[model samples]
Target chain A: MSAVASMRDSILRADTRLSKYHPLSRILFYDDFDEGVNGWCELVGNHAGNLDDIREIARDFRPPQLSSCTFFDIGTHGSIEGTYSLKLATRAVPNHAAIAIKRLTYMRRGLVQFETYFTFKAEQTFDRAALSGWDGNKAPSERQFGDFSFSNDICDGENGKRYMGLVRYLNTDVDGNLVQKWMHKTSVQPTTRMERQGVVPPNQDFHTVNPDDWEEIPGGNQPLCFNETASKVNWHYLKWIMDTSRRRMVELQCNDNVMDLSSIEVPVYDGHYHGLPNLLNFLLDVRTRTNVRNFLYLDSVLVSVDW
Target chain B: MLRRSFTAVLEKNSTFTSDFATEPYEAGWALEARWFVRILEISPGAGLTMTAQISPDGLFWCDEESGPFCLNEVGLASMPLRNFGQWLRLDARLSGKNPHVKVLIYLAVKG
Candidate 1:
C-alpha cells in the first residue's frame, strides 16, 4: 500500500466511531441515533392531493420512532452506542408492515455500501399457548416475526430505467413455521401506475408483484440470535455492497457470514418512469406473521461510496 | 443546538365507522406533545370523541389525565399533552347513528 493510503487507514482506525465500519473511498453519511433520526422518514406511497388514492398495501406503513429499546421487564436496554435507535414497528395485525426510508441522490454511482447494527423482535405477549414438548432455549416469539427487509430505489434518470434491489430475512412463514432464511425477490415491485393500468393485481407483499414471488438464496439458511426471550435485544452487524454501474448486488455480510450476491438478479421496471433522476433511496421494513407487532431497530448507519 | 421536533402523520384521510385507536408512537425523549385531528368529511349529525392514551410499554395503554376532545363538525382540532410516558396514541370513538368520519391525524413532539 502507498504511504498516504496507509496513513489514512491508520487515522481512520484511531477513531473509535469509524473503526467498526469498512467504508469505501468517500464517506457519504454516518447516522448515529444518539444524535437523532438523520433524514429517515416513513415511506408513503405516491398519491395525488387525495390520500385516498394511495394503494392499500402502501397506505399505512407506520411511522419510524426514536426508541430507547426499553421493555417492561428490563426498563431500558438502550442502544449499542447511546440512548436511542431508529425503530420501525408494525401493528399487531397479521401481514401488517412498517417501513422507513432515507432519501439521497448520487452524484456518480460506482459502488455504494451501507452498514448498520440492527436488531429485530416481536412484541411481548402476556398470554402463552400451551406447548406439548418445548425446548427452553427457543422462544415462541421468534416465530411471530414474519420478516424484515432491506431494499433500494434507484432511477437512472427521467424516462430511464428504474429498478429495486432487495434482500429479506424470512424468520417465519405465514403458517407460523420458522423458516430462518434469506431470500431475494423474483418479480418487480408492483407500482401504483402498474395497478392503475391494470397491469398488476393488488399486492399482499409490498416488495413484489405477488406474495410468493420470493426464492431462498443458496446457503442462506442462518438462524440469528433471538436470545431466548422477547425482552432481550441483540444487535447484529450488516454490510451490503452494490455496484451501481452494473446495477447489481456485490455482497452481503452479516456478522461473520459473507455471501456473494453478484449472481443475484435485480428486477427492473419495464415501463419508463418520469420525474426521478439520480435517485437513490434506502429502505428498511418489518412484518409480523401473527397478530403481534414486530419491530426492526437500527442503532446506527454508515453509507459510503467509491465514486 | 436547537430543540429537536418532529411531526408525524399518524393517520391520513382515514375513514372509520367504528371505534379505533391510532398506532402507538414512541416519544420518550420528548418533553411535550400535541395531537392534530383534521376532520375532512363526516356524516350529518355524526361526531368523534378522541382521548389521549399513554403506555408504559408499547403494548398496554391507559387514558391520559386530560379529558377527551370532541369533534362535532368538519374542521380541525388540536390537543396539547404533557407528562405522557414513553408511548402515545389516540383512541377515537364514533358517535351518532350509523356514523362514519374521514379524518387526518398528526402528532407533533418536541424536546
Candidate 2:
C-alpha cells in the first residue's frame, strides 16, 4: 500500500468502533443506535391521502424501535456496544413482517458497502407443546424464528431503470423446519402500481412476485449461532458490497464466511421509474413463519463508498 | 444535547368491530409518552374504551395507572403516561350493538 493509504488505515484501526468494519475509501454514514434511530423508519406502501388505498401486504410493516434487547429471562441483554439497537419486530401472527428503511441519494456511486452487527431472535413463548422434544442443546424456539433479509432499492435517475437487490437468511420454513440457508430472489418485487394495473397478484412475500421465487445460494447452507435459547443474544457481523457502475453485487461476508455474489442475477424493472433520481434506500426486514414474533436488531451500521 | 422525541402511528385508518390491542412498542429510553386517538368514523351509538398498557417485556402486559378513556362519537382523544417501564400499547374494547369504529392511533415519546 502507498504511504498515504497506509497512514489512513492505521488511523482507522486505532478507533475501536471503526476497527471492526472494513470500509471503502470514503465513509458516508455511521449509525449507532445508542445515539437514537438515526433516520431508520418504517417502510410503508405508496398511498395518496387514503390509507385504505395501500395494498394489504404492504400496509402494516410495523414501526421501528430502539430496543435494549431485554427479555423475560434476562433483564437487559443490551447491544454489542451500547444499551440500544435499532430493532424491527414482526407480530406474533404468522406471515407478518416488519421492515425498517433508511433513505439516501447517491452522490457518485461506484462501489458502496454496507456493514453492520446484527442479531435475530424469536419471542419467548410459554406454549408447552412446542417444547415437547427438547434435545437439551438445540432450542425448539429456533424453529419458531423465520427469516430476515437485507435489501436495497436503487434507481439510476429519471427514466432510468430501477431494481432491488436482496439477500435473505432462511432460518426456518413455514412448517417450522430448519432451512438455514442464504437465498436470493429469482423474480422482481411487485409494486403497488403493478397490483393496481393487474400485472401481478397480491403478494405474500414482499421481496418477490411469488412466494416461491427464491433459490438457495451455492454452498450457502450455513447455520448461525442462535446460542441455543430465545433469551440469549449473539451478534453477527455482515458486510455487503455492490457496484453501481455495473449494477451488481460484489460480495457478501457474514461472520467468518465470505461468499462471492458476482455471478448472482439481480432482477431489474422492465420499465423506467420517475420522481426517483439517484434513489438509494437500504432496508432490513424480519418475517415470522409461525405464530411467534420475530425480531432483527442492528447494533450499528456503517456505509462507505469508493468513488 | 437536546432530548430525542418520536411519534409512531400505531394504527392508521384501522376499522375494528371487536376488542383489539395495538402492536407493542419499545420506548425504554423515553421518560414520557402520550397516546393520541383520532376517530374518523363510528357507527351510531357505538363506543369504545381505550386503555394504556405497559409491559415489562414485550410479551406480557398490564394496564397503566391512568383510567380508560371512553369515546362514543367521532372526535379526537389523548392520554399521557409516565413511569411506564419500556413497552407500551393500547387496548381497545368496542361496545354497543354490532359496534364498529375506524380510528387512527399515535404514540409520541420523548426523553
Candidate 3:
C-alpha cells in the first residue's frame, strides 16, 4: 500500500503511536518538507492556483539533506552558511508571501492543531522603529505581515474587507456552502473606522498610544517580545489549536507560553473557491522592504484531529 | 459544521459595537458559538469589557442573559452561546488606566 494509504489505514484503525494516548485517531497529516516541496502552491493577492511557482523557488533554494533528515533550506543565495532558511523577500517577483496546500478531511468539530518549528532572522533594521541609525529616527509606519499564518476557505464572513484589513476572511453560507459575500460596516468604533480611513482621531485620555517598554505579564502570548528576531539562535516551536467543540476557541503555544485567543471569529481567509478547508497551508509573509535578506527556517509541520 | 465570523474593533474607553444577523437556523445541524479577541495593538495595562446582547428586533436589545465577559491580556476569550435568540451583537468597553486596547472581537457561531 502507498504511504498515504498506510497512514490513513493506521489512523482509521487506531493503530498509530498516538492511539495509545487518545481514544480518537490522531495525526491526520505530517510533513517534514522531505517530499521535495511538491505539496505546496503559491498565492498572491487574490490570484491562487497551481504549484509551479512554488516548486521553482523550492528547487532553487533547496539545501542538502540535514544529515539523517530532509528539510527545506530557503534563502540560501550564496550565504556562507549555505541553504539555511527560506528567504521570502518583498522585492521578489510575484511579490507573494503565502503558499497553499490541502490536507485530509478532519471534522471541523474536532480540535485541529497545526504545529511547526520556525526561526525568523532579519537585519537589525527589520524593526526600523527601534534604532536604524545614529540619528535615532523611527521607521515609517506600515503594516508588517504575520511571521506565519494558516488560512482555509472554510470561513466566509466578509469579502471586501479582506484586502483592506490586516487579514482576509471569506464568508461561509447557511448550508456550509462557500460564497463571496460583502459585509458593510453598520456598527464600528467611530475612531477605529476613522483610523481605517487614514484619519487619526484624538487619543482617548484613558488610553495610551505608544509605550517605551512593553512588559510581558508573566504568561503572555507566544511569539512574545522575547522571541523577536534579535533574541537568540535557538529553534522555536509554535502550535495553533482551533477547537470547534464548544466555543470555537484558539490556543497558541510558543514553547512553554500559551495564549488563548478566545471568542475569535474566522481568522483565516480563502480566496480559492473551494468550499472545504482543503487549503490547509503554512505561509511566511514579509510585507515591508528589508535592507538585507532575512530567513525563516521551517521544519516538521503536523496536523492532528480528534477523530 | 457551519461557522460565521463577526468582528468589533475596540478603541480606548470607547465601546465598539457589532451586530451580526445570522441565517435562519436549520434542522439537523447542531449549533455552537464562541467569541475571541485578537489584539492588533494595545496601550500598556489595557483591559476591555465585552458583552453580548440578543434582540428580537435590531432596535430593542437586551443583555444576553449569560453574555458579559472581560479580558485583560490578548488571545481568545471564548464563551459558548448555549440557548441563543436570533439577533446577536457584541459590545466591548475599554477600561483601566490608559486603557487603549485595539482588539478585534470575533464571534464564531457553528452548527
Tens digits of per-residue lDDT for model 3 on A1-307? 8998678667756844233222224776655442323244333222134222222222121111111111122211221122222323222222123233343333445566666554443323334444444242222211122232333323322231211111111122223233222121112112223344454343221011221111222234223222323323345566666554432436656667665545444332224233433223334333212233223445445667775
Question: Order of candidates by TM-score, top first?
Answer: 2, 1, 3
TM-scores across all candidates? 0.97, 0.98, 0.37
Q: In model 3, which regions exceed 4 Å deviation?
A: A1-24, A45-89, A92-108, A123-146, A150-152, A155-232, A244-247, A267-284, A289-292, B1-111
lDDT of 2 by residue, B1-111 (tens): 999998998898999999999999999999999999999999998889999999999889999999899999899999999999999999999998998999999999999
Per-model TM-score (chain A alone): 0.97, 0.98, 0.46
RMSD of 2: 1.0
Residues A131-246 of candidate 2 have per-residue lDDT tens digits of 88888899988999999999999999778888888889999988889999989899999998899999999999998999999998776788999999999999999998888878
The DockQ-based CAPRI class assigned to model 1 is: medium
Q: What TM-score, to 2 decimals, does candidate 3 have?
A: 0.37
After superposing candidate 2 on the true structure, give the runs of residues whose Cα lies further than 4 Å from its correct spot: none
**Model with the higher TM-score, candidate 1 or 2:** 2
TM-score of chain A of 1: 0.97
Q: Which scores greater on lDDT, model 2 or model 3? A: 2
User: What would the DockQ be for model 2?
Assistant: 0.83
Residue A127's lDDT in candidate 1: 69
Clashing pairs in 2: none
